[model samples]
Target chain A: MSLFHPTGPRVGSLLSGSIRQAAMTVARRDHGTPSESDGAPASTVVEARTSGPSAAPSLGPSFRSSEVIRVEHLAVSYRRSDGAEVRAVEDVSFSVREGEFVTLIGPSGCGKTSLLRVMGGLLRPAAGQVYVNDVLVKGPMPDAIAYVFQDFALFPWRTARANVEIALQLKRVPRGERRRRALDALDMVGLAEVADRFPRELSGGMQQRLAVARALVSNCGILLLDEPFGALDEQTRLVLGVQLSQLLESAGRTIVFVTHSLQEAVFLSDRILVLSHQPCRIKKTVEVPLPRPRGPDQVKSPAGQRIEAELFQLLYRESLV
Target chain B: MRIRPASLAEAYVEVGPVRRAPWWSPAGGRARLRGALRGRRLRVFLLRWATVLALIGVYEAITRLFFAGSLFLPPASEIFTRGMGVFVEEGVPEALQTTAVEYGIAFAVATLIGLSCGAALGAIPGARGVGRDLLQVLMALPQIAIYPIIILFFGIGPGAKIVFGVTHGVFPIMLSTMSGVGEVEETLPRAIRAMGGGWVAVTWRAVLPSALPSVLTGLRVGAKTCLLGVLLAELLSSVNGTGALVMMYSANGRIPQLYALTLGICVGAFAVNTLMTVVERRLTRWRG
Candidate 1:
């Protein structure tokens, strides 16, 4: 749809052959895709992926033209009020190519969110640095990144449309223009009708969708989703997962998602970065050979199962369970 | 005695047969009455008026029958009619004007200082603990005990009343605001920062809006306390203002006139509280 049309240099290549192929798949179905058909098998395939590896050689060089986010030996630590020190992320290094979907999946409280925060410049890393579009990430770079928090950090006092308009307002967009853009963003999320409804009035799934709309309206090249669907039920998660994949297909923005759901990782990611328990480190980077604008049946397919099994085994081993 | 079943269907029934009522029946009428009262706004209005009229009726009855010549408890009708004469009494209007000015200035000053100080204390980590402790200490003090000190500093004029009012009013607002600002979720400010908002934007957009309910609660409490402080100052000084008028009436044993003046004060307090409530509802309409 034109709603996802290129608004900046980042999305300029959205209509290119590869991305169009994905957009076509999205266009073939309505917003509520029939994801229920494969729900059972799709869920069972969670967390299985290829053997331990940094990156698949075959997929390299094809999309390495631009590295939008680079995390170099990034380490994060927190200090307690009682003067105790606790390490969260340790020596984590990775790079995300433009328009790639990278999923950070790990056990609960394993610092995936901490790593995402560091990349978004919401938190200052104790060691190393993050670079977004070649700019050092010492602090928030709203121009380059938009973050969707796990709890759907919506402003309770503002309606859905107003919440979406906040980032634009911060950027000093004209009132009339921001209004239009906000409505358009809400429409894209199928929430145009409830644009005037406060966050508290929305359902859990709708709230998450509204949060996504807010992030989208920012029009940032890099989207950071910290377990955006973690609070949702499994059924809603699957549906939203499918819808998000389609939306990202058309938007063509690089995404760094954090989640604990194996099925979600398998369904939405181009690469799954399995993280170890606290003092988080990248345990393995599994590349999904599955094509973009993934079909509903893909998660239940043999290849998807193979990848999920590998991921599950890796995490199972990492957890020492 | 032995009884036989009327019919097979009746025998199979678990309980006695149901008796349906017609529209004119008492049961049906009562049900309809309940349905009518279910209209929320109408019911609330009726209930409120009923309570007020009942209280006034009882007070009038008791005073007229039992305390017919009582100087301390005059009839409600006299308070409304003869008591209202206090409005036109000499110096009463001037005292009202003085009180109004004092209230307006004190409330405005308290609101501004309370909000700013509260936001600062709440937002600044280093200041939060110390600010909280200081506010607690101030809140704990018997504000009335300082009336003499205020009188000495500002004299018996409106200055003393305003200052006293502010002292009485500012603590609730500051404390409420501090807690309100402090209670704002960490994610909100983080969202603003991620959107490239600096300290100013975070405070204005995130901190202020999020802390508003608490700040408003503080303001409401402060407003009431401030009014009390000013009135008490005037009453104690007994030199000028509405409090002085009240003191004069009571000292002279103008029982009806005193009650009338007291009733007027009650109305004024009610009006102020009502105005605050309306404003609070209007601003927080988004909360719905």
Candidate 2:
């Protein structure tokens, strides 16, 4: 029985069976390699499809790279306006391989954005540690990472090109290179024509692309996107999602995307981490086995539908809780 | 809901659709011009003016007909006819020049000092509370009652008027600037910081633009207050200007000249307000 098929037993049982299979597959892959059994290879091990009662689709070969990010026992809390302490995220652990695309998906207020913020060093976790390429994330390391906010947080006063140029200026990139790189990033996002236009002059979707341009032009190895396409209309969202997938494919940078939309996650991610409600815990990690260079045709494939249905089921169950 | 075409037709007749003509048509252009002229807002403004004119006419009639023997009440026409001549009198003109100089100097000094101090206080939380309380105290003080002391110190020249004006104008600007900078949204500063902006960048890019509209508002308030301060000083001890001219006409029982000078002061205030409004509009165009 396929774990993703709707005809399976309750989603929880399917999820448990898949997790067990993934664990066994990871154990076998680790046994083959001479690497130490410190759960490090498990972070990069791609789960294999097996003949079992809860067989999941096989993930492709792993992209070999050292861990770019390692988050361990992370917990975050905030004081409410009424002075009550509310824990947003608690004891969540995950790691991402270099050049990999990992996504975090859950219902609203599940603290996916909070976890991304912790990784980006924008918000300090109450407990546990986040390591970026072996160094602890004490503050925003502009050289190592860049963040794209959901609201297309471009400076309203600046033109699109200027917005992209800002990060380069901060890094003290040479004047000519700054201009070239900024233009190049805008070109990637198909916003070269609107480079001189202010944020107000462009549509909401265009503004988000400009934000992506800004992040990409920084040339940081790790990119954190916090629901970047959440504000767009449905049609615009789909178009931009494909464009983003292509952009990331070319850039080959590690991406950790946070979104509430399951379809978006299934469409863009190599691995989707479903999170439970607040004091959020990672409930399941599903590997997307569909081959990339993904397009509209790939989106309509049987494999895509299966993945989408599985993600939706996980999200629906999470919402009920 | 009744689908009654006849009733709908009757309703349309009672409140006809506004017929819009093509923009390039001669009659259309004329109609647009007339519509612009006869808009509801324009009608309201005209009605207000008509009321004022009628009141003035009644006052003129009462003075000219009912108070024939009285020298204190003069007809409005007589005041209008002689007002410009009195304004051009050598003593009056010199006094007016002195007041203008005093107003300019005081307004400029107060604006600079207030803006700098307020910006510093507002930007630094430690200074904001104490600075605001001190400013409140200054604002609460009776500025006019201190004229005698100002006269004793500055000795009734343009210096005294400038001092008085500064005292009156500085508080509003300071208060406004403090509130303006304080009211800047937190998100803007956070966004700047996320972009790797330091304190200087955040202040220049985010805080300053957000606070500008309020700063302009402060400037307008300061201008009006400075004008009031200048008038107060002149009324108390000035040797020349519109205030001095009013005093002189009143003492000599020149009712018509006094009335005319008062009307001139009203016009001057209106002109100042209109100029400030135009400047404010131009400078704050980026707000939209």
Candidate 3:
């Protein structure tokens, strides 16, 4: 089973092996022509195998055509106070296709964030490598990847518009273009009215929206969201999730979203990757059979309920261990 | 699933926008009257003025009644009447000019040194530990004890006085600036880096602005200390300046004129402090 070819028939064969060796074989085989496996007909095979009895429908030919990001046998660990190494994420390998929304879900402290950080080049992996557009990610590629942190790490001093403009300013975009694009991004998040207000002056939901605006203003092809709506209340989370779905659907950008909410995972993702408890590894991969541009209606649908129920069972089982 | 209120109107009656109460209404008139007299700034201002006027009245009453003929305690009225004599006195205006020049130069130099040294200590991890300890020790030392050393190095001219003022003023500014820079959150720098901001941009956009409020506070405290240092140095060794004039008036037993000169200096210090406070508040408006 090759991890790089996500929709291949060989997915169920490999488990708990040395991924480094497997990665080399897979990388060498699929490195040059990554999208060869994602042909139009292969998506139905994906739906039948992963979605099972509640299979909805695929996005058809034009969607998820090529590979934009590849992670090969990635592992993340950090040193403890006594100098012992504690592995957080182990043997995690996945690929995000162009314009696909993939969610990583697991119990708390499962190192889902570490995997995302490794992909963003904010945290270095102990093993394996991440590639964006076939270029190895050694450090933050601000031009190619924009990250929305869980904590809404906005500059307290700058106004909302200025905060969004910072992304373009870093790339040395001219002043006029920067202003136009920053306002446009703010408008997309329904925050154009409060564009001149400071982050602290905004409510929690608005602040997260401001963070999304900042990420969007960069015009990057890929976005890495780390529990962006984690701190909000239930209603706000649903609203934001719906807004995010609409926004991403239009933009056709690749996204790797990390979250803890089962309903959120089922509602917003094209595919959900469930991870095991500690020393995180892929526990199960569920293809969302729900339709795109998701809203509250999707979560109430029968397919959404089945996916959510499966995810809850997987997480509940892991918690007992 | 539980049923929600089909309409909020089912739980409570929905009302249209209420009309405003007329000014003649009893409750409205009473509320307006209370509002006119109830405000934080107004209360504070009235209290402050009352305290000053009461103290002046007490001084006037005590000196005129209890110390009627004493040379040491002149009446408040006599001092006010003789205050104009301070400017008219020979060499008095020249002495004031000298003090102003020394204070101005010392303040400018201290600000320059304090900002640069503070920024260096704040920005560099290597310097922070040792530099902070050294600053702490210097700040705690009684600056007057070092006056003789300053005189020995710079001589008993305006140079010595200015140097003394700098020593007294520099510590507060430096310490505040250092702490301001140090207290900037680690997330801010990381956020800037993630945006592709280099070292200069991070310092300019994140570090400096975050530290500004603390730096302004230090400046306010430094202004008062510098003024004190200049006056103390003048009183200790100089032959001319406002400090020397105080010495001469007291020596000649001109008590009312001496009181008048002291009052003038106090007024000037008060004005400078008030001005600094306003500036600090103006710049850190975002804190609100």
Best by lDDT: 1
Between prediction 2 and prediction 3, the one with superior TM-score is 3
Where does model 2 sit among the CAPRI classes? incorrect
User: Once superposed on the true structure, which residue ranges of model 2 sit more than 4 Å away at CA?
Assistant: A1-65, A169-183, B1-81, B120-160, B239-242, B253-275
Each candidate's interface RMSD (Å, one decimal) is: 22.2, 17.9, 14.0
Task: Give every collision pair in model 3.
Answer: none
Supply the TM-score for candidate 1. 0.85
lDDT (tens digit, per residue) of candidate 2 on A1-321 = 100212323322322333344454335433432321332243233322112102322332342136789899999999998999999998998888765689999889888888998898878899999999889998778878888988867777677898899888877788997888788677656566667766766677677878998887777778999999999888667656765764565455789999988778877877888998988999888887665545555556898889889988988987887
lDDT of each: 0.79, 0.75, 0.78
Q: Across residues B1-288, which tens digit of lDDT does each residue of candidate 1 receive?
A: 011212233233313234346559999887667766787766888999999999999999999999998889988998887888989988888888889898999999988889888887887888888999998998898888888888888988889999998998999999999999988999999999988999899988999999988888788889899999999998998588889889999999998889988888888988898898889888887785
lDDT for A215 in candidate 3 is 89
Q: What is the interface RMSD, in angstroms, for predicted model 3?
A: 14.0
Give the per-residue lDDT of model 3 (tens digit) for A1-321.
Answer: 212222222212211122243334334433432322322332332223233313434443453346678888999999988999999999988777766788999999999998988888888999999999888999889988999998988888788999999889989999998888788777666566667777766777778888998987786878999999988887667656755764554444678999999988887888889999889999988888664434556677887788889999999999999
lDDT string for model 3 (B1-288, tens) is: 111111233112112123345558998777656765797756877899999999999999999899999889998889989755887888988898899899989999999999999988988877888888999999888888989988999988899899988988899999889889988888777778777788998899889999999999999999999999999998998888899889888899988889999998998899989999999998886675
Per-candidate DockQ values are: 0.25, 0.07, 0.19
User: DockQ: which is higher, 1 or 2?
Assistant: 1
